[model samples]
Target: MKVIVGLGNPGSEYAHTRHNIGFEVIDYLSEQESIRLTKNKFNALFGKGKIGDTDVLLVKPLTYMNASGEAVGPLLHFFKLDTADLLVIQDDMDLPIGKIRLRQKGSAGGHNGIKSVIQHVGTQEFARIKVGIGHPQHTREAVVRYVLQGFQGDDRAAIDAAIERSTSAVKAWLTQPFSQVMNMYNSNK
Candidate 1:
């Protein structure tokens, strides 16, 4: 089984914020595939269904972004799945808005959610798809405020497009190898 995790904080207040872009992709995938995220376990909301011929578990951690590993590590352990079976979708402030990048493995690169996942999972060798949110400023405070806020006007349109592309890449991952998916998606950048 393949486990797809989208990192985001819980609660309506964070619904469409830049930091919640991961959750947005999961939501889109769920709707398109008819996968109902009705199960709550390991502090996560998840659903299991078939994506093409692959068995997939779509997850949204309820422990919030900073502590995402609390849910992800346990879930993978309980299912006896390896990190190789995992795919994480998250937002990236380093890339321009609407861009998406896929990596087979890497460090968190300052993302608290990915850092948490790496900590609990005990490795940096897992697939991830990063949707760019664009940096607002160089200061830490400004970065925090920017990520937690919702996108506006043109930014919103760009984000919407990015989300669509992210979902498509995810579906492709279910059928093809991670490296192939990365090559297919990353070359567009």
Candidate 2:
């Protein structure tokens, strides 16, 4: 079975933060499939279902962003799945707002969540979908505060569209070889 993990900090305080965009994608997919993320295991809230013909487990890690590996690594082990069977989705500040990038394997690029995953999973050779949140225009603001802030106005529109696009990418991964999906998705500008 394939696993789709969405990285985000848990708790109501972080609900709509820019850093929680991964959670937003998970919520969208769950809603589309009518699956409730009620099961609590692997330090995550998840639901079992099919994405196209592929059996999948949709997960939202509850270990918060930095400790995401706490959830992902165990789930991989519990499911008897290889690193290749896992897909992680998280926000990225390196691209323009609303952009998405899919890579077969890579360094964390400064994302704590991805770093933790790499540490626990013991490799960077895994799949990940990076949804760009974009850095704040105001350079003076603390990076942490900026990521924790909610999107507003045009930023909101961009992020909303990105989330929809991200959902489409996830669907493609469930059906096609991930390399093919990466080709189709990583080209998005």
TM-score quality measure for candidate 2: 0.95
TM-score of 1: 0.98
Best by TM-score: 1
Candidates' TM-scores? 0.98, 0.95
Q: Ten-residue segment with the worst summed lDDT in candidate 2?
A: 135-144
lDDT of 1 by residue, 47-137 (tens): 9999999999999999989999999999999999999999999999999999999999999999999999999999999999999999986
Error of 2 at 160 (Å): 0.9
CA lDDT scores, all candidates in order: 0.96, 0.89
- Estimate, for each residue in 33-116, the C-alpha lDDT of model 2 and write its tens digit: 877899999799999998778888899999989999999999888988899888898999887888998999999998999999
Clashing residue pairs in candidate 2 (N, C-alpha, C atoms within 3 angstroms): none
Candidate 2 Cα deviation (angstroms), residue 33:
1.0
RMSD of each: 0.8, 1.6
lDDT of 1: 0.96
